[model samples]
Target: MTNAEPLFDPSLPGLADDPYPHYARLRRTDPVYEHPAGYWMVSRHDDATAVLRAPRMSVNEKNLAGAPADDSAPPPELPPAMVEATNVMNLSLLDVDPPDHTRLRSLVTKAFTPRAVAALEPVVTELVNEGLDRIADGGRVNLMDELAFPVPFAVISHMLGTPPADSDRIRELTGRIHRSPELLDEAELIEGMAAIEELVKISREMIDWKRANPADDLLTALIAAEHEGDKLTADELVAQVLLLYAAGHETTVSLIGGGVVALLQNPDQLDLLRRRPELAENAVEEFLRYDPPIQQTRRITTGPYPLRGKEIPGGSLVMVAIAAANRDEDHFGEDAGKLRIDRADARQHVSFGAGAHHCFGSALARMEARIAIGGLVDRFPSLELAGDVVWSDRVELRSAKVVPITV
Candidate 1:
């Protein structure tokens, strides 16, 4: 509704508010809808899954070196800041291919194992309790601002060894970076670039500090990692830290914020969840399927690939719409459109992506969501919307800017 038309336009400023309706139409009609922006949009769950799992589909955009000046002079060398930024970006596990990705992922994989996540349950619950207590006495509050934002912010900050003093500022910076890195205009992009410069500086200092004073945190683990006796370079370390800042809280916030908003919209489901709190597990799964945090991710085809009965050319850009795929009736049966917490296949939803690129932080995200949602309902069974809801003005990551509510 924010846009003039109802068609699913991923480029629309307000499409993030309610993209599901358009996604449904696409799934029913043009499962392989091609956007005018020169990209194939794979909507069906099966097709999206195939594209994601395809080894030929790659994210090898690591060429960040020179910027051309003019015909008169030679290629202008990248500035130090830009070089550092590029280094920070390229070393990310999310952007590299197999061998590098595998090595980088292994460095911190132990920290997110099931047992490790289970160990975090009590810590997450305590954080959730503190978040709730901040609004326990108030008649109304913006859940996104108070609980949803702070819970993941605090958890991830602690995990990364970010000082409590810098948590709020870092949270603000990370929020802008992760919400829709691909959606920023030139002005915002410049501003974000400046912010990243400052963040890169701070991250460098933190890495050095962690080296001197090792701790039992993910940062320390990453700082100590060595790939076949070849440690991560300074730029690589900086890049990994920046990636964490960009990704850590955004998806978790989206999950919690979107789940709370959706439950408010569907009180019947909320009531069902409240009565059988054991359904918290399934409820979190359904919430992810119903309204995922990160909607779509891009992939570049290295060879001709057939999808939805069409042969996409070798060098095409395809958007695997995770939001659309999750709700595809062909994949989720007749009640695909409905929010049923008890849906058996809810956990199978591609909200976290698929194949080798499946989210590295999924277990941590799920644990946080379950504890946050379960603890909230247990604390305030009478929670309800208090004011107008405001959705983030983005399409890639669907999240509420504010979910005003009364406890």
Candidate 2:
């Protein structure tokens, strides 16, 4: 590992607002810097990829040091109810280990297969057009609220057979739960948990309803999936559905939001994409590399592992800074900081992650982004930013709370 000093604290304020600079420092200085937040931060491309792919690293919370013996318990300041709901509903394919993760992911992967996502292209295109139609007559629109957020939300909602009318409510609940970990005190955590409980209730009811009368949706698929002659239990079904609903929409929302911001900031890149509409796909890849939705993912060391001459004990936390890895000079070249839409190595970035936990819905997310972005430029050639951008204070997911733009 390169000997470099860590520039910014991952836990500092406004860090999420712009972490690329900090990531750059970490990559150049301390590639595997240890953070006081109780984790080793891997900022370099190769190091981050190694941690992500290493079998010794696990997503299971059980590996978290000093964590409650009951995996269902919330962290120190979190409310009990919130902890329980988080433990129950958050146990999707992302939070488990090999056999469990593999089994759970396999059961849901069929629904997100390339063919399945491709089939939704027309539908996604139509949805994008509809959203654009709403804003076509507008003076200004918050792209996140009006376009970016709704596109993925609608797509995922339809995939799960959820009514379009319920999208806003679901979004509110999930957004709260996602941001709860960043809250200052136990009270806020309690409120966040309450919101999560409500989400759980809604998800559970939906699963029950789907079970009674199955539909051709992902929820129905998960409800029907069997492993070793046994089907997913009610709790397992609730957990998986909730996880899908949150993960399926939230990250994509950020990608579209961040992608729009990236393009607007780099007019040259934006102009190039507009000129070569075919480059929409490449642009999406660049968007992911330049400004990924999910910035960091946590892993627990399941066994003693030697990384960059440091021996980390089992149960130690490892925070992989994906946003940093994408911009690593070693991986993307000296001009990595420059936005090159035509960069041949752009798709090699780790925005959707790598290895066993690579995003299953990456293709779907890309399809939505391509059609939505390409269609926007086609319909509104004069599209431009209308006001200051306001980003979410979320650490894990980087997104704009509001991106005012004009058609």
Candidate 3:
């Protein structure tokens, strides 16, 4: 199970169900392992963190081995229009480099500040209570469908000024577009393009509507952002809005669902959380460390670089296994495999990433998880797993396809 032994294949089935064991073995044997895909696989905490924070590593796929430097270049092996569509939709701060990333992130950071996110605590509490109220008397409940999926969407929709009626549609589009790259084939890519186009139209309509009559929501703030006496262009506005919708919702959904599955598997941890409800905040941290929403993140070496005594050539693709890093015994002790709700060092995990490109909506996400999980336990003190849990096939975004529970 060493990293040199091919612990698990990204293309394999059922690997998502339990990747931690493999991750542990990799960290122990090969902290900086080379993969057959012509990239370095960083599986240890210190090594992964160093790579993520390294200036030589770039988030832009263009710096990668197979991607074009610009959108105008001939499309990659993707279907005729897939590459173009993806390039257009991926204009978020996540994909951009420093200056532009700094600019885009600054605009949205104002809305996601600690004060702003803290203010949403009450709103999040109410939203979670309402969702749990509907399912408290349920015979069987799919937590993903009934709770985990909707609460964050509702919160983001409120923040973005999207109508409540459109939440489900927007959620479906975001899910399809961000769930997994493997699920996206030629046809699915086209559908994803259409989804983004529809979302852009929706964003434009909202922008115009907000311009006519504004509110204190994030949308209004985004519409008001100006730099060097220049406001966001129509296309930039659409891209920014799409980024928030997808990232703000999908990742939080995965967090809640994955957290629940982890707690269920470790009833001792769940019981500890139940007994010391005040530990909810720290428990959320443990959840992120124990089973992060994002399993792996890809970057490219901007120049020939040496890591762990091996040379990674310029334009080499590098996959940082965040899940593996979180489980690294070097940082979290040998018992890192066990879930400790009150683990003081849990906050050191890179679940929300690190560096300038760290997750912009992290505060809001933590708020949502704390409220949702706390509210659930408060409402149904006897909650337990009602059926077998099922993880999604997404290798990049680790999440459950279905999570059933009973009270």
Candidate 4:
């Protein structure tokens, strides 16, 4: 029904803010779409699930921009900064395949357990309440700035045993790497990589400290994690911790900001939530379904795979659109497009992805949103947008830079 040749272009102006409409059109017409550049996308719910869980699909692709390679193609001269950026990209558990991914993720899962996350609820509640106290004196405030950003940043920091004094600088450093490196200039890109290196150094020092004086924290637990005569190396520990730090802080920030805006836009659902505070659990799920934090994640195929009954070639980048799949009518029923806070199957959405690569911090994210979003509605029933909301203008991250609200 739509004539858009490339529906998945990232450079479009408003694509990041509202991609569901585009996703709907594509899902109806072409569920398995391939790009001229050999990049394919699987947008349907079942296809998304299959591709994510398929043995043929791989996450260990070298997606570095403007970097040297040992392949057949002639090498191009690249700046040292860009090469350093590529090196940092390689350090992530995101770019590794099994055995390595299995090892790192097993250690991470042990530390980021549901029990560990549940124990943090009291502290998370106190953090949200303190933020509320600051906003109470001021009738109007930017929730993204005053509340949403700080709460998760604090929680992840506390979990990692990162010093409280270094919170602001660490937060600033993490902010530098949230967006794509290609979007930045030479100077900005260098600064971002430097921030990453600095964080790695900080993590390495902490790992050493934890070894000496063990504590009851995620970092200490990661240090204590060991397999049958095998354990994480120094670099693996630092990299995994950095990955956790980035993923933990960044995604939760998007959830809180985008979830609050969703409530403001739907007054009836907002009122229902204010009336029944317990709906917070279900509300968090719907918010992720309605507008997921991460839009698409890229993976490559190792061999031929069938998608939507069509066999695509091997070794092509398949961008799985989580935002689109969550909105598919076939999977979520007739009212899939609507933001129903009480939707029963809301938890079935792939907002946190599926299978092995699924987000490790989903439990922590949902709990934070329920407590923060739910607690706010309970305290300030009069919460509504003060002015126009501004979204983060990027293709990958679906979030807001500002949400002006009056409580």
Candidate 5:
């Protein structure tokens, strides 16, 4: 399990079912591990936090110093259709560094501010109640479809003022494109690339329509958002809107779905939450820490990064295991593995990440989860698992694909 023994492969079977045990072993034996996949996996909470918060850490994939100037033929050019898609990917908020990252973030940061997100509480509550009503007669209903997906999807769609008619297609495309970041073979990568191209096309059409018809929504705000006499270029607007529209709801879907699954599996905590509904906010934090929506995030080293006694070389890819860090025994003590709704320091989890690249939709996601999950708990006093849970294959955005439940 330690770095000295052999290179580790994080894509081992059954990891999605439970990664904490593997993460625990890595934290104990090789807190800072260099994986054979040309990346470093940092499992400890302290190391993960340091790497995430480090100013030198980068998110740009171009920072990876590829094999020294190979004399082989240059790589083939991307298809014309893919060029636009690739450009959109390059301009993504998750892939850019500062100045660009700062600019892009500042342009829309106000929309996600706590005050702005608070204004959506009534909207979120209404959506949550509506979802509950849909599942009121439920006996073995799929929470993922009934509550998790619809709530966030509706919320983000409303925020973006996107056409509700296209939601089904958008969800499918987003799911396919999101698989690009996970462990994939050649065929899967090609499929993901195609998905990205499709999403970009769809997004462009949406943006074009939004322009002709402006509304008091996030998409309109992004369309008009400017900073320092700078406005988003047409392509930049498409990129940001696509990012916001896609990423905005994906994580919240995980949060609500995963949060519900956690409670169903931990009866005591569920009972406690039922008894003390006031702990809803703290319960959301605990859910994030116990089983984060995002399991890992990555950064590239701009310079030698030291952790424990090892020094990761410059230009190396570093995968910060946020899920592992959240459960680090040294950080959370012996009960780190257990879920406690009232865990005082649960908010300290790096689930939303740290530093400049922290998730932009955090406040919105929190509000959605708090309301969606809390409302469900309140509505169903006798809720229980109807069958075994089935988790999504996605490695980063962890969530149960299906949580069969009875109310």
Candidate 6:
């Protein structure tokens, strides 16, 4: 279809630059495509939403047919240290099933609820203003480094009560770790695993420090969190902290980075947002709908799944294309491909996903984006794209590595 064999291939030319066209083609020709890679790709909005909403759809790889019962066990070829690092990740909310997901999610669920996130509004505003202040006197600066990454990164770090000095190292390691799902070669996979190992070490050290220096922060609360006298194990703590540290900012980075680029590209929308900063809230949802950070999320079907009239075999790895679904014409209307900050149904987009496994940090991410993006627009009326947008090589975690801008 569209002359792009195995449309899921990340190495395809210009894919990182613009994937929406291909996604549109897939949605048109094959809404429920079974990829040659032994995975299924659901492109239509309805199908994607249905797959994500299905309670039986499993997030854990071990649920797949013929998969190892103990999915944490590494093959003989992989290094033991690598396996150990991945095992820690295996305990995170992103890679678990119902009971464990329910338990782990419930533990910290209150921390990120809308009301709790609202309490952090003052802190988020301060962080956003500080980030904007840094870029105010700038001529040309990479927004990714200056505003986009730092604001969310600072927010997450502040919440976690992590040592500020260790952030650069954490950023580097997390960048590497986020590349794991990019269909890596053996060597690349090994490198990613190594990064995970180092990050796990850092997380453990941080957790221990938090134990000694307990404070009124999310990290301390996590350390103290207990459900029916059952606390998160040491490994689970490491996994969760790492997940929060990485995801807490990374997705929002994409939001701010990609959103700004979209606005700059569409001058009309930029003008509208600048004139009416109140649209910032709606703009955040539009940004997510237009160009979502996490493009696709996967679900391992525990039983035969019917999607768009086809029966996908049990244990199938089905990719729910969130980005594509966000732009589905049937769902969002004919101009779904276009960016409209005022779109009434913007929040209806499945960018944060749906059902049980919806993103826990959605409230926080939205708050940060609203403040940060709104602050940027309000402060810099003449903010212009000064140079090319350097897109990240990541397919799943879609974001620009650099977005040079001048205010």
TM-score per candidate = 0.90, 0.93, 0.91, 0.88, 0.94, 0.96
- Candidate 3 local lDDT, 1-407, one digit each (tens): 23354654676666778877778777777778876535678898888888888988888887777775556763555554444445556676778787777778878888888988888888888888878977786747999887898899888878887654477687776657664554467777767767766676666677677777778788887777732346565556767877877556888999999888888889898889888999999999999999999888878898988878888889887889999999888899988888999999999999888887788888888889888887887778778898888887777888887898998
What is the lDDT of every predicted structure here? 0.78, 0.80, 0.80, 0.79, 0.83, 0.85
Candidate order, TM-score descending = 6, 5, 2, 3, 1, 4
lDDT by residue (1-407, candidate 4, tens digit) is 24546756655667666777888877887889985444687889999988888766778665333224543242255445444444554556777878788877877776568888899999999999998997798889999878898899888878877554366677677777766532567787667767776777666666777677777888877777632337676566677777776556878988999999999999999998987878889999999999998887777888787776788777677888888899999999988889999999999888887778888888999999999998888889789999988887555667788899998
lDDT of 6 at 48: 83
Q: Mark the 10 consecutive residues where model 1 has the least summed lDDT.
A: 62-71
* Candidate number that wins on lDDT, 1 or 6: 6
Instruction: Please provide, for model 6 over 1-407, each residue's C-alpha lDDT reduced to its tens digit, 9 standing for 90 to 100.
Output: 24437766767767888989988987888889888767899988888888888988999888777887765567899888879988888899999887988989998776787788888899988888888888986767889888898888888888788765466777777787676265689788888889888888888888888889989888888888732258688788888998988656899988989999999999999998977777889999999999999998889989898877799999888888888899999999999999999999999999999999999899888888888888888888889999889887777788899899999
**lDDT over C-alpha atoms for residue 28 of model 5:** 83
TM-score, cand. 2: 0.93
* Poorly placed runs, candidate 2 (over 4 Å): 1-6, 72-83, 180-183, 226-229
Cα distance off (Å), candidate 6, residue 367: 1.1
As a whole number from 0 to 100, the lDDT of residue 305 in candidate 3 is 80
Whole-model alpha-carbon lDDT for candidate 4: 0.79
Best candidate according to lDDT:
6
Alpha-carbon deviation at 46 in model 4, angstroms: 1.1
Predicted structure 3, TM vs. truth = 0.91
Looking at model 2, the pairs that clash are: 4-29, 4-30
lDDT for model 5 comes to: 0.83
Summed backbone clashes in each candidate are 1, 2, 0, 0, 0, 0
Which candidate has the highest TM-score of all? 6
